[model samples]
Target: MERKKLTLLQTVFTAGVFSAVSFWYGFMFGRESARKELGGLIEDLRRGTAGSEPTPRSS
Candidate 1:
């Protein structure tokens, strides 16, 4: 019947849409975690450099 075919098509379309959205969310999550880790590493380097510097003496 035509109704059965239409139902099957709708089901397939819904599944595809859900899969695409899920993939997008997972990608965003991974990107954000990487950004945070890199930022933390840069901050640590800055702190280390600052601590190792010698102070200037004025006459």
Candidate 2:
């Protein structure tokens, strides 16, 4: 019984650690992607090219 409990605890801990690491990696990747996109948008705005394309209106 003790061994089973220890195994279960270890498994849960490992899963939790993996989940946290995956979440952190995903969050960092998303943030970097957003930063890059925003940087491009800012540059386009600064160059006055942002308004050259017509934006689609959502009904």
The local lDDT score (0 to 100) that residue 34 gets in candidate 1 is 81
lDDT agreement of model 1 with the native: 0.80
Per-residue lDDT of candidate 1, residues 1-59 (tens digit) = 99999999999999999999999999999998888777766776877854555444322
Error of 1 at 8 (Å): 0.9
Candidate 1 stretches with Cα past 4 Å from truth are: 49-59
Candidate 1 pairs with clashing backbones: none
How close to the true structure is residue 32 of candidate 1, measured as C-alpha lDDT? 86
Candidate 2 — what's its lDDT?
0.84
List residue ranges in candidate 2 displaced over 4 A.
54-59
